[model samples]
Every structure is written in structure tokens, then in C-alpha cells.
Target chain A: MMNCKEATQLLSEKLDRPLDTKEKVMLGVHTAMCSSCKQFGRQMEDIRSLAKQYSKGKQTEEKK
Target chain B: MIEANPSLSASEAPNAALFYDQEFMESLRSQMVKFATLQVQDAQLAEDAVQEAMLSAYQNIDKFGRQAALKTWVFSILKNKLIDLLRKEKRTTVASQLENGPNLQGDALMDHLFKENGHWQKSERPQKWDDPDHGVENEHFWRVFDACLTALPEKYGRFFMMREFLEMATPEICHNEDISVSSLNVTLYRARLRLRECLEDNWYQAKESGS
Candidate 1:
């Protein structure tokens, strides 16, 4: 069973591109089984999408 | 005689004019100047940092990497320059900065992520981001996003801006900062979480009014 640490690392890198077959299988199986890991994966994906907005030509700055 | 009210606003805004013009340069200057002041808390020093970033950008216009848009490119330059300025300030003068490193936040790394009884923990888990029901055409989203960015501590906020806003790859970012790839990944994760949380608040408020 993949731990949260390993799963999250692979998830983060996957945002830029596809993972290897072995990694994909491991990550796929891990996320599918662990609800928390699934939630964490979803959040990481969401972060990538939202992060893309900052790359867009935003008319005004978003203050944090 | 031609002076107009600050509230009057421009009649027909020329967005493209921001590309290259004295006025546009001034706008960039002011933005960097203000952000720098906030982080370093030194007007003269901040001005110097802003000046360097602005001038360097102006000089290297042709080299502007198209990977990130213009605003992002400029911000990245300013961010790097600001870090240099802080390091310089810390090393030579500012005896106090030398002693305490001008850092108030204790264990900023631990504050960001730490283990308690061997369990990893963070301060707050941000809400998830969705491809909005109405989709990307939403007009006012950036305002909410920027607000969240402003609330972040300067160091984290700046790092987040470089990665997300500037489209800097994680490996490149880590190399630039001499940080590990995992460290950069976690930093980006936290930055996005905070932004998502803040944007969700705005979306909820909008929904309450309509529903």
C-alpha cells in the first residue's frame, strides 16, 4: 500500500505530465482505495487548475 | 485645466498601451514599489529594488519568455530582485536583521507543515477548486484570487506567485531556490489551497445573494 507521502508526490508531478505505467498503476490503485488519498488527489488537481488562473492575464490582482 | 477626477476613470481604456509606454512603465513601477514596501517595510530600499526590476525588464524586453504572460514575467523579476535586496540588506547593514534575519514568523517551515506524534498536519485545509458551473467566463474571479494572495505571508506569497503566476516549472523553481523538488511541490500545494479557500468564500457570498 502506498503511503500518503508517496502518493502526494506522484500526484504533484502528474500535474505537469503523465506518470510511468508502473507509477500510474501504483498511484491509481492507491488513490482508488484510500478515500483520504483520493480527496488529496482531487485537491492537487484542483490546485493545478486554479494555479493556471494566475498564469492568465488577470485584469486585476487577487489579494491574498 | 485638463485635470480630471480620479474617480472619473479613463474614457476608453487602451489595454494594449500597457505593453510599452512611459505611463505603463510607471504603473508597473508603482505596483512593484508598493508590494516591495509591504514585504521589506523600507520605502527607500523597496524603491531601489523596484527600480532594478523595472529597468532590467525594460532592458530585456526581447528576452521575455512567452511561457508566462507579461505581467507574470515582470512580477517574477521583481520577486527575485526583492529577495536579493533582502539578502543584501541582511548581510551588510541592518544589524538587527543580521541577528534575527528580519524574520518574525517562527519556524516558517514548521508553521507551513509539521508533524505531531508522527502525523503530518497543516493549519487549514482549503476547499476544492471546481470548473465552475458557469465555467471560466466568470468576470470577477481574479479579484477574489488576488485578495487571498495578499493575505499570505510575504515569503510564501512571493514563492507562490513565481510558481503559479509565472508558470515556473517545479524543477526549475527548486533549482532557482536551491530547494528540494518535494519542498517546492508542497509549497505550491499550500499556496493553491489558500487561494482556493478565499475564492470559495467569495463564490458562496455571490450564491447567497442569488439563491
Candidate 2:
């Protein structure tokens, strides 16, 4: 079974692109069983969303 | 004297209508310098880029034709200038930067966080962060975030920004940097790990205690 460290690494890779079928199932299983990795997934999502808003904030400043 | 329309709110004013005038370019000057400084990491170079961008924009003012937001048009010019500066730096400082090239030495830090079996070390497991929405509302949080980004090794920092802020694709980044796709992925992953840890320690943990 993939451990937390490996699973979290895959989570970051997923951020860059879509995971293949086998990697997807394995990450799904690891995250489903592990609350910590699940939380880490949410955090990556938060960071990416924050990046969008961060740049948008700069654009808003550009307007003035 | 013409009377202003008191009924129309300030927010109702259109930015596009102002693009052709010098007034809008003047307003963007400081903000452009601020953004360029973050990207290029030097106050003098950033100012040069901003000045060059603005001057070029003014010279080509007629070509603007109000087709885009003045801000977007001017910022793209600034981006080009910054890239030109980077290429210049690349040519002149190849020897010094050879040591600073994209590297995977971040593995030492990762090994410390994870054991041989790949489980997270007890001391290194990620803690639950503070409420993210409220966290973003705090100006101090962004200050810390910027500090964390600046702390990253220069190459990793630029690569991360190219991917995150500039939103470049993996292949595009690899081709531009002349690195393998796998190496780029590893570098990006390590960059995220370091950044996340830094932000958690400096911002989120501090928030947990303050509240």
C-alpha cells in the first residue's frame, strides 16, 4: 500500500496534470483511507485557488 | 462649468474609456514597478522595465486603439521587458549561475520529513491550517506568503512563478529551460513542498496561536 508521503507527492503531481487510471485509483484508495492525505489534497486546492486570487488582486490594482 | 453626475457611482466608470490618455499610463507606473520587482527581484531592474514599458507604450500610443484594458496592454509590455532582462542576465552571468541552475538538492529536506518507508515523520506531519478565507483577508498573511516565495532558491522560485502566476504548461517550461520533463516535475513538486511548509509555519501556525 502507498504511504502518506508517496500519496501526497502524487497529489501535487495531480495539480500539474491529470493522473493516469492506475495512479488515480491508487491515490483514491490512499486518500480515502487516510484523513491526513485528504486534508493535504484540500490544502493544495486552496493554494492554487489563492494563486488565482493573488494575481487577480494585482490586476485589480492595475485598473487604478 | 460642467456638473458631474452625482447619481452615477464611482464603480460605474469604465476603465476602457480612459486607455488612450496619458492619465491612465501615469496611474499604472507604481503598480507596474511593484509587480516587476516581485518577478525580477531587483528594484533597479524592475524600475528600468517599468520605465521602458511605459515609454514604449507612449511611443506606440496610437496602436493601442483602446482594444484592451490599458492595464493588460501595458503589463504585457512589462512582462516582455522582464523576459528580455532575464535573457540578458542569462548570457552575461552563465558562470556564476551555473551553480544556481535547477537542482534537486531539496531531497535532503524531504528525506528529513519522510522515513525510509515513506511515512511522514511525526514532527513533520502537516497540521490543520486556520480558516483559509479569513486567513486571506489578513494583509499580514500575504506578506508572509511573499517572504516564503522569496526564500525559495532563485531558479525554483522563478520556475514556480512561471507555472503558477504565468500559468505555463509543463512542456513549454521544460523546453524553455532546456530541462527534461521529469526534472521539471520533480523541481515543481519540491518547490511546492517547501513553500507549503514555510507558509504553514509562518502564517497558518501563527494565526492559530493569535486566535
Candidate 3:
């Protein structure tokens, strides 16, 4: 069983590279059972989009 | 006024007029300065880089037709200028700092979040962030996001931005920074963890409490 710490590290790693089958399976099982890891994964996705908006200078422009 | 005149070469006219627009130039300058300042961590050095970039961009305005957005071209120039400055000032504190590996403070923070058994400390587990998509549109929310990014230790912030903002690939970043793949992975992981906690504490929880 993967602990939350390892699960979280895999979560972050998947952003930068594709996970092998074993790693993906472990992450899927852990996150399915762990709401905290699940939420952490979702928030990481949110942060990626926020970072995109930030790169596009969305905050500096007025709301149109 | 130039748009009204068709006598000038059609290919070259519009962008030149845009390059000369006072409002567009001012806004672009401010954005460039902000980005440079964040990367270089020095106001005066950022200003110098932005000024040089803007000047070269203006001089090369003729080459800017239909190739890329003016803002994109200008930012590329600024990025190059910043790299040059960083390389030239090799022995300076900022350069030396970049060469330094992640600090002990970062390790302590990680230990605080994770227990000896590699489980999240109960109190440190991530919580739900409600309606995060909507939060992206909120101006105040972006301010909080910016603050969280700025709060990251300098090298971590730079690496995070290089990956996220600059959209550089992992291997490319490792090549540019001369770090091993595993170290880059660890740095990015720690950066994301800290950024997540910062946002949760400062924004999501505050919003939940209606504070």
C-alpha cells in the first residue's frame, strides 16, 4: 500500500512525465481510497490552470 | 490615422503603428518589468533588462509583422537579456544563490508536513478548495496566488515559474539549470506542496470563513 507521501510524490511526478503501469495503478488505488490525496490531485490541476492564466497576463488586464 | 492611409506598404504598416501606440507600449512595458523583476529579484536590474529589450524591440519593429504577437516577441527579447545579465554577473550573490541547492528550511517544512511513516500529518493534509475554477476569474484571487508564488524560496519560485509560466519541459529545464532529473523532480514536488499549502491557508480557508 502506497502511503500518502509517496502517493503525493507520484501525483506531482505525473505532471512532468508519464507514470509506469505499476506506479499508475498504485496511485489510482491510493487516491481512490484517500480523499486527501484526491483533493490534492484536483488542486494541482487547478494550480496548473492558474499558472497558465498568470503567464498570459490575465491578472494585469481589466475584466472585459 | 495610419490605418486610414493605404499608400504605405500594407505588410509593414499595422504593427508599426501598434509598436508606436503609447497605451499598448506602456502596458507591455509594465508586464515585462513585472516578469523580469520576479525572475531577477532586483528592481534596478529588471528595469535595465526591460529597457534594453524594449529598445531592441522598437528597433526591430519592422521584423515583427505576422511572425508573433508583439508582446510575445518583446518578452522573448527580455528573457534573453535576463539570461545574459545572469551569466555576466556570474560571481554575484544572486548567481551564487542559484547554484546553491535547496535550503534546509525546505526540508524542515517537508518533515513538518509528512510523518516518519511517509503519511501526511493529519493536520497538514490538503483540504478541498471549493469552486476553484471560479476563483481564477476573481482579481483578488489572483493577487493571493501571486503572493503565494512570491513567497516560495527564490530558486524554487524560479524553477516553478520556468516550468509553469515559461512552459518549459522537464528535461529542458534540467539541461538549462544543470541539475539531475531526480533533483528537478524533487524541487518541483516541494514547490507544488508549499504552494498548495499556502493557497489553502491564505485563500480557500479564508474564503470558507467569509473573512
For model 1, state the Cα shift of residue B53 in Å: 6.9
For candidate 2, give the docking quality class from DockQ: acceptable
| Chain B TM-scores across candidates | 0.49, 0.62, 0.64
By TM-score: ranked, best first: 3, 2, 1
DockQ of each: 0.23, 0.37, 0.50
RMSD of 2: 8.0
| lDDT (10s digit) by residue, model 3, range A1-64 | 9999899988988889999999999999999999999999998888887788766646433453
Query: For candidate 2 chain B, which ten residues in a row score worst on lDDT?
Result: B1-10
| Per-residue lDDT of candidate 3, residues B1-211 (tens digit) | 3334444453555566665568987898898888887666779999999988987776676776653356767787887787666555532333226634444336687798999998889999998888776687677887899788877876777778878877778886666566778888888888899899989988999898985
Superposed by TM-score, candidate 1 places the C-alpha of residue B129 at a distance from the truth, in angstroms, of: 4.8
Question: Could you say which candidate leads in TM-score?
Answer: 3
lDDT of 1 by residue, B1-211 (tens): 0122233223233333344456766786787787777545678888887777765654555565452256667776887776666444532222123123233233453344335331235433333445442434455565565566776655556556666555556665555555666665655554444454456566634555657
**Whole-model lDDT per candidate:** 0.56, 0.70, 0.77
Clashing pairs in 2: none
B63 Cα displacement, candidate 3 (Å):
13
In model 1, which runs have C-alpha deviations exceeding 4 angstroms? A3-9, A16-23, A34-43, A59-64, B1-30, B34-130, B133-135, B201-210
**Top model by lDDT, which number?**
3
